[model samples]
Target: MGLYHNRPHVQDIRRMKARGEKISMLFVTTPDEAAAAAAAGIHMLSIEGRFFDATMREAAGDCFVQVGLPYGGWGSFNGRPLATAEDYLRAAFHYAGIGGDAYYCAASYDIQKTLADNHIPVVGHIGLIPSYISWTGWRAVGKAADEALALWRHTQKLEEIGVFAAELEVVPDRIAAFLAQNSSLVMLGMGAGPHADAQYLFTEDVCGYGLNHKPRHGKVYRNLGPELARLQEARIEAFRAFKADVDGGTYPAPEHVVPVKDEEYEAFLKAAQG
Candidate 1:
């Protein structure tokens, strides 16, 4: 509970948006990243439930963290997605209990409302949802007037459903700016635009260690790929050296082992003969 008290509350985040503050956010998957984000004064963090725990909360320091609940039909956990609204509710509660300031729900609106109904601060997603990637493909959404209008309408609906925030992904800059200014819901942008309340990016992309093709909106602050490669080579070299020592009988030199007293060895030999 003491660890939880140090973080920014949901109200504090809303107040920041109302004041037109530009928040910096990052998607982090490890405790080390969370600690670093907190140390670097990042305002928000989006962390999945699988990677979140008490240690992670402590590592996050004062950064507001949004814990992602597993959504249905996108992928499976234990061979199935969260199968019901109750599953989503239970998951959200679990993270909230662990000091999450908000919950990220990409599930149905009904499930989102269910969480909100229970007083959970929930963040919804609109415009190029990754769960629906099969239908939309991996591309920018809301490029045209019709699509932009639809995105705007959907964002309004999310606000009506009691969502505290919405993630705008890969939409046109004009559309994103319009939604941020016009809607009550705080808009967190990832490849959307500069006018969003918060700008979000994955830590991997920022560090240039993402294994796949980088997204168009990704801005790399450091090239960590080569350094990671160097570390891997060093790991292999160290393993080879250890193997050579074992094969050459140099690993367990006399100083590395213990010896029995002469009297004890003689007594053991006498007992064996008996």
Candidate 2:
């Protein structure tokens, strides 16, 4: 839990984000995905609230796991959906029990501060925030001067409230660079360009199993789709073989069966006949 622990200090992540370093990684939704990401030397990860348990933590090894608390709209904030700051605090402590390195939320500033006050490293969302897409629509945000400027201000506000890092999603490189250079928060880029402190992508999108075509920014290192399909086929075949053996009475061979002694059988039959 000491030296080998994959989680870095909150201040450590802050320093790196402030420096505009390229923290390479993707989000994982399963133990197997986390294990694979850890094995690949990816330093950071985002795990959904559903996956926030001891099993996933053990599988993640030393990699950073940012537990995504379910707020609503997947990763968005609409209305008073999250309710109060206690919601964030409770979820933070709950997941932290299993060694979650950080917390990701799209809640309001008050809610974010509640988590931070309790010593939780909160990762806020910026640019193309899906939950608040009503204002910006479902497209790249911060492209225009005013939009970029607003995002810059948003970054500043997050830092002011004591957040450790922010996810800068789906903005252009130039705007992302400017925000990265100015803000104190760690900029986790999801197609928001190389200006971010870390590059973030979803494990599903990277594995070629995404519902939509792979985005231009996502670079697939492995194609597990076909591999997984092939494995499923093999499993089905193995089960079929066992079923066939059972139906044909070929499973319990002579060496596998025991027989009653001839003397015992003869005595039983003779007694019954008499």
Q: After superposition on all CA atoms, how large is the RMSD of candidate 1?
A: 2.5
User: Could you tell me the lDDT of residue 178 within candidate 1?
Assistant: 94
Task: State the lDDT at 215 in candidate 1.
Answer: 94
* Candidate 2 lDDT tens digits, 1-274: 3335636666667766665455876888888989998888887889877767888888888788888877754532323344568756766787887788888888888888888888888999999887787888888888789988888889988999988888888998998888878877888889987778888998877887666767777877678788888998999999999999999999978888889899999999999999
Return the clash pairs for model 1, or none: none
lDDT of 1 at 104: 90
Tell me the spans in candidate 1 whose CA falls farther than 4 Å from its real position.
Answer: 73-80, 247-249, 258-274
Question: What is the lDDT for 271 in model 2?
Answer: 100
Error of 1 at 116 (Å): 0.5
Highest TM-score against the true fold, candidate: 1
Q: Give the least accurate 10-residue stretch of model 1, judged by summed lDDT.
A: 71-80
RMSD of each candidate relative to the true structure: 2.5, 5.3
Model 2: residue 122 alpha-carbon error in angstroms: 0.7
Per-candidate local distance difference test = 0.89, 0.81
